[model samples]
Target: MITRETAGELLARIPVSVPDQPEGESPTAVKASPFTGAERRVMGILTVPKWQQGMDQGVLPRAYQDILDVVRDAPGPVRAKQIAPRIGLPAETSKIEGVRSKLKRLVERGWLDEGTPGLFTPSHAWTANSAKSP
Candidate 1:
């Protein structure tokens, strides 16, 4: 219920104390690169999709390529489900289904050639011979 003149006098009575900071240490000084170890860990978590996409080339999943190298090197067609475990996926019902979904997409994208229904081989066009072809 204080009047404006009284309020101003009361506010003027309060004093603000700010400690004197040393002038030598700059608040905006250039520190070390923020990309050092701990920050890299944070960025690594953020960039996983980009990293995975680079590994996948947008067609195969990261999980597939881990096993694809083995499958593609095999003499004959390799079944999609068979590659799941070697790529670290569980062979159990639900997880296998997820792996199968990605494998089917890889097959459809021409990144893999489905030799027999579920059996796959890498497309020769994606191989070393790609340079030789038109």
Candidate 2:
């Protein structure tokens, strides 16, 4: 076992190299925006906008659009388990729960309606608005 004093001496022998920057470049230079020149807005999965008249479904991500499509094509409100298979997900309990959480989020965002427990359907406002559009 080496003493603390000997350890310090050993560490002091290690050479540390610091990179030298050219005269013009500053360390904190502003970087270009990652979204530069992009036309569409970027949003996280949970940041789905509330349903409104004339809102385009293109604003949503593909996974969300798929969910909405499945629900819209259904005869009535659908359960998460029923949704999982149609969306290409295996009908496992965990997958069902994941779909349920997304459905709940859609309801909270006004994109869907939860008229009764465990059943999800498109919100009335969304369906009505979509029907009026060409």
Give all candidates' CA lDDT scores. Answer: 0.57, 0.78
Instruction: Give one digit per residue, the lDDT tens place, for model 1 in 1-134.
Output: 35767766876787744345456755445355333232222212322122211133333345656655766678888775677777777788787777667666666545567777877777655554434545
lDDT of 1: 0.57
Worst 10 residues of 1 by lDDT: 46-55
Which ranges of candidate 2 are over 4 A from the true structure?
1-46
Instruction: State in Å the error of residue 24, model 2.
Output: 30
Runs in model 1 deviating more than 4 A are: 1-61, 129-134
Candidates in order, TM-scores: namely 0.47, 0.65
